[model samples]
Target: TVFLTTHFMDEAQALADRLAIIADGMIVATGSADELIGAGSTNTRIRFRLPETSQLPDTFEARRDISAWELETDTPTRTLHELTEWALGTETELLDLEVTRRSLEDVYLQLTAEAAEP
Candidate 1:
């Protein structure tokens, strides 16, 4: 058995054959990706197509702390709800304002990375 710890969340996700995380060195969560993803939450990616493809307001929902949002939800429905709201709010002159499920890779990248690390 390998007893290990890492500062990189990606590293934690990668080497985590069966992950057990401790926020303050105290066990807080434990599970595989699916288990953790299911048990914890997920984010949604809102992809929008503006009227001119440039008219898309870069601003996100400030009140929701969703200006360019990246937050976790207890269920997939939660993300969908926020996505719908976002789309409706932006559909005034936009086309294809839709929400997509945030992939595991997406979360991994967002949580601890900007670009892929080597």
Candidate 2:
């Protein structure tokens, strides 16, 4: 397994076979995107035909206090729950609700962030 430090999340995911994440010098998490997402990150991005688009804010403003926006999450189930709950509360109707898993990039960013700390 090769561990590379990268600011671009996509680069790390493309290069890695398996991901190992350590934060604060502790083993925070480890797994393939599939494994982690399968274990939970199953969320649906609901797009409603509101006759106009309300561009959702970035993670910083949206999920700052949630584990989903944290450096890493051990179990994505709780995080996924939080994401859906937040989404439902924000919008009126949820259409095109496609249940999704974590992207390789998201997973890689977490791993890289963890690997970067001194």
Identify the leading candidate in terms of TM-score. 1
Candidate 2 stretches greater than 4 Å from native? 49-101, 105-118
* Total backbone clashes of candidate 1, pairs 3 or more residues apart or in separate chains: 0
Q: After superposition, how far is residue 100 of candidate 2 from its true place, in Å?
A: 5.3
lDDT at position 117, candidate 1:
36
Give the CA lDDT, 0 to 100, for residue 23 in model 2: 54
Alpha-carbon local distance difference test for all models: 0.50, 0.49
Q: Write the per-residue lDDT of candidate 1 for residues 1-118, one digit (tens) a residue.
A: 8977665656776777776655434455566766655543445545444444333334443222222333344454755565556657856443454556555445444433423334
The reply for model 1, stretches above 4 Å from the true place, is: 41-63, 66-118
lDDT of 1 at 24: 33
What's the C-alpha lDDT at position 109 in model 1?
A: 40
